[model samples]
Target: MAKVGGVVAAGFLGLSGLIWFVNLPYPMIRRPVAGIAPMLLLPSYLSMDRNYREAIAHVEQADQLVNQATSAADIGLGAEKVKLAQENLDQLPVWFLGYEPVRMCHFMGCSWNFTFDEFSRARAQVGRMNARIFQENNALTQLQTAETDLQKAKQAYQTATNVSQQQNAIADWQTALDQLTVLPRETLAGTTGATKYRNYERDFNRVVGSVAGSNQTQTMIAAAQQFAALATQNSQKSAYTVTEWQQIETLWSNAIDRLQKVDSTDPDYLAAQSYLADYTQKLGVVKTRLETEEKSTLAIAEAKRQTQELISSLPSKPNPDERNRLISRLQGIIDQLKQVQPNTTVYAEAQTLLKQAQSKLSQL
Candidate 1:
């Protein structure tokens, strides 16, 4: 009976040892075994300690890389380091072990305690790094897009043949510059964008000046000025005939039309606008003059016709009622003649007719 009990005990001890040996690599599985034979888990504890140390090292290196990063490539490398650190932290079996393996093996002169705090901190760092990477990458994309637009705008401006094309190119160039101005200054791409913006702004102004100095813009301005001068010279005359006033009105109108055609993109556009306003006012004046001349000429003719009709209709020696009617008609003709304004072609004729009507009224 004693010998059978000894054999069974030997078999049980051998099976337990085999289980401990096979489960040494897995902390969760070997944790219970450690309670029965703590000495058997020394190798597993040392391995866990190494992983923890490696994870901490990775975290430090990642932090350093990220802090010093100046470009997207540097940030990418930092991201890889962060990933490696996370992988190392994941391998650490902190769930089953309450203390670091280094702490468990205190005789090895290591005193670190295992806690999820460091793991959590690492994870937080990863989140921050990822956010930074996203920001930098997005800024890089913006920088690239802005640069491409700037190049295209330059090309367009250099090759443009017309004012419209040059204006469009300048507009595009301004849009590109606007894009660069909005980038975050902390990013590598943003810094580069800023440097480019200063140079591009100067170029943009130069291009605008070039477009303004183009032959088409200058020619248009000259033509507008010529028309304005002609209109000014012609409008200086007073008391113009209806036909003459109409021609003066046309001259002012032509000047205004030419000024209106000057493109806003031209540097001379503001001057053109000033000329346009002046010309438009002159046009209104000339048009008023033309209208007055036509009206005055018709009024004088009408007054003369009425005077002749009154003379013909007079009853040789008019009765008191007929004389009063004739006098009233003459007074009305005089009043109408008085309304013919100065500066009209009919003013002189209207004055002569007014005197005749007044004399006829007095005679009646």
Candidate 2:
């Protein structure tokens, strides 16, 4: 009887050791998956010691009100708070919140393939092209860098697909999980690579002629506007020095270019045309200013000559009314001259001439 009792105790100890071994690593592995677990699983674990330790903390503060409640009405109020928390939990989609752990693991592995495998090969390919930009921008090697980034973007798209798929698997674990995982991605679709990478690809395709022929005209117009801005800045022409005027022309040209790319009925094209008219009006103002400057210069010259001749023809005392009228006319000319921008050759020359006229007037 003593030996049998000893054997029974030994068997119990061995079983307990096995259970401990299995239970210890389970939580560690499950720790990562805890957030992804479904609402249905919450009730089952609520009775467990480990569950209370891991998750109850998020809702712990609400427990005091629940515990202190003395009536059904108070309990109902406490339950309402718990329901609100559950609703908040639902707001985080299963794809984003539940399956995120599995998705993260999958993405980390996929990222490594692009960085070491695909990117290195793409860089080698661009290296063979002998791209001029590589030399000019000292980024000859950077062509490979861009290709590497492009390849990585493609890989990220693939990883997004896998992450999405893993979320579906997690959802299949429970019906509620399925609803949480599936609904949000269906509503708002997005690809893997960063948004900036997508935009870069769009602008690059337009610039490099990868886009269809229909878009070519718009692309050319955009390029032309860029060139026009460069010309306006560096051109020796005085009227062109007005950067704002050049910008107006650039806007008009860009709008026309963009307009040509789309059907005339397209709203974007119509919007471009509207912007074109606005910039065109601005350019017209610049042209009008230029013309006004030209006319004002001639009027100033004529007024100076007439005043000098009149002064010479007069006796030592000029006619008081005529002298005053000439002075007033001279002052009007100066005011108009002041309105002209000094960047123009006509305005600069006129300013020098006006100073001389003022000196002569002072003598009178």
Candidate 3:
């Protein structure tokens, strides 16, 4: 009977120790057990290491999804992954083992070497992923709203019979475009919005320009004034590309056309005439700038072509005639570079080439 009681007591203690070992990674079990037998807390450290690695894997997966997400569905999936990662990280006892306890555990041949810093960094990565997902979802919503607004504006513009209605529709259209413009470009929705914006702007300009020969003189004058203002604003800016200058030129032309639509019998005919004169002058100026930009671009291209040819054909040992020919051609290239006007898109490039050409000319 004594031997049986001793065996039974030993069996109970063994089972209790096994239960305690299994649950030591958890705070509730580790708090009491660690106070009495801190050496046995190795299981808790091992569990923490495992959780940290799992959280890291989840974070990486979430990051990949968020970066490549093209739709709301993708963002939703990424959010789930990040949330799981956060939950896993939350299981770590960062406060409990952050100092002396972790250092002591390191001496016990336990391989759980994760630091508080590593844990914090992993949490921060998860946080950033969550933020990106939130931003992407918000961008998607904005895109949908912008698209709806665009459709409404188009419908209003197409059905309007009077100038006031058309003007209001135009305002709505601009607001829609503004929404698209402000979307975060790193997001999928923003990229889609950009493409839509380009198409919308082109179509809107074409539709606005199509209004002509209407008896609504006030409408014609108002449209003309708006185009004139846009043209002036664009024209006053420097460093416009050739294509940009051409668009500005088109604006001026559109303004002039609108003013010409005003009938002589209309009440606003005199005002339209005044606007026509001013717009025509601005159109002429825009045309001049366009011409300069084209000529300068052509000059730079021709200079580069000549320089390349000269480089390919130059003799290793040149006589006076060959040397003189090279110098003449280089001088011509320098002249071409000098023709590129300031405030043109290619002006900086041209200036850089000009210095090289001048230096080469002197060397020749």
Error of 1 at 9 (Å): 23
True-structure Cα RMSD, model 2: 28.3
Clashes of each: 0, 2, 0
Best model per lDDT: 3
Expressed as tens digits, the lDDT of each residue in 3-90 for candidate 1 is 9999999999997888567555565667676666655666666656677787778778777777677767787888888888778767
Whole-structure CA lDDT of model 2: 0.44
TM-score on alpha carbons, each prediction: 0.48, 0.28, 0.48
* Candidate 1 vs 2: which has more TM-score: 1
In angstroms, give how far residue 263 of model 2 lies from its true place. 2.0
1-364, model 3: which lDDT tens digit per residue? 9999999999999977786774654566667765666656666666666776778788888988898986678788889989989988888877565332544555754433567777778888888887888889899999999999989998998999999998788778767766886798889898888898889867876776534223235555776788888887877777677899989988888788868856686667787888898888878877888888998899899989989999999899999999999898889888889999987888999999999888777787
Winning candidate number (TM-score):
1
Clashing pairs in 2: 134-139, 134-140
Pairs that collide, model 3: none
RMSD of 3: 12.9
* Superposition TM-score, candidate 3 onto the true structure: 0.48
Worst ten in a row by lDDT for model 1: 96-105
